[model samples]
Target: MSSSEPRPESGPTVPSVLTWGTWAAVVLVAAQLVLGILMLSGSWSLIEAHAGLGYAGTLAAVLAAVSAVVWKRRGGSAGVMAHAVAMPVLMIIQIGLGSAGVKWVHVVLGVLILIGLIGLPMSLRSARRQSL
Candidate 1:
């Protein structure tokens, strides 16, 4: 390569979801845990707990959507594409449970969302590596 020759076009520096989205995912997990605790302690009503958990789940879904958008924007990897699809699916399940006010569904979705929060960072790291 010569100094006069131009380099290939580098992709966007930031992921589509960015730091805020990741933080939102994190917050969602923590908030869901707290909401669950509140429900158990009777400090909060079931409806309130459901609402809080739903909010967190929605945040995670948004993060996934943003990740997918970012991937599309940068022409990134398949992993991001997966995140885009999976996140919304999980969010829908999460919200349905919240709205239906089902006990087991709420618990299961809460667990799944927490797993998603933990898995997302690892997934992003893998995506970054693959993109590189």
Candidate 2:
């Protein structure tokens, strides 16, 4: 390595588990939204798949929350940690709403959850860049 050449910086890398889990949750939530729209449009046959994905999305949210906690323990942002923790809680309520047959609230909450899930990764990346 020459002095004139740039050296690779070494520091904390963004948490892969958090990033991957958040994206997975985002995908699951988006798919659920689509399945939901279809069901609302009279395609009741997709209900089974939609319900299955909702459970998976909840699992993913919980995992992401765990990863966020780990990240915070390792000097991550408190706001990010809070956001991560909230995701799963929201998901649980969303699930309950769905189960209770409150279709409109469930749909609205699902959209909000999807937006949150999508924001998580972006926030992680921004924090990484700021730390660099």
Candidate 3:
């Protein structure tokens, strides 16, 4: 460990947790969207499953956000951290809207959350590359 020697790069710390968590959240949101469509078409039986998956998706989003914070502490981008943190917040609001019977707003917010989840991995990758 001489001063003149280059240290080994700690590439993309927490990539698996952050990236996979985001992907899981994305998949859950997509499934929820399908369930929502079915419910709108009068398939009320799927509502319980939809509600269950919403909580799971929110948990996954929270995991992603926490991992992003860990990544930032390990020298990742602040922007990426902020982006990851937004997902769970959006999920909570979306859940509230759904619980309050505000169908239209809930659906729109769900779509936006899905879009954000889809973008999370790309942001993580970009931050990793920048760090390297």
Q: For this target, which candidate reaches the highest TM-score against the unseen true structure?
A: 2
lDDT of 2 by residue, 26-81 (tens): 99999999999999999999989999999998898899899888878867777888
* Lowest lDDT 10-residue stretch of candidate 2: 3-12
Model 1 scores a TM of 0.71
lDDT of 1 at 100: 78
Global local distance difference test of model 1: 0.64
Model 2 gets an lDDT of 0.87
Worst 10 residues of 1 by lDDT: 5-14
Q: What lDDT score goes with residue 67 in model 2?
A: 87
Per residue, candidate 3 scores C-alpha lDDT tens digits across 14-88 of 458888889999999899999999999999999999999999999999998998898788766788889999999
Give model 2's TM-score versus the native structure.
0.89
TM-score of each: 0.71, 0.89, 0.87
Tell me, by lDDT, which candidate is best: 2
RMSD in Å for all candidates: 4.0, 3.8, 3.4
Clashes of each: 1, 0, 0
Give the local distance difference test score of model 3.
Answer: 0.86
Whole-model Cα lDDT per candidate? 0.64, 0.87, 0.86
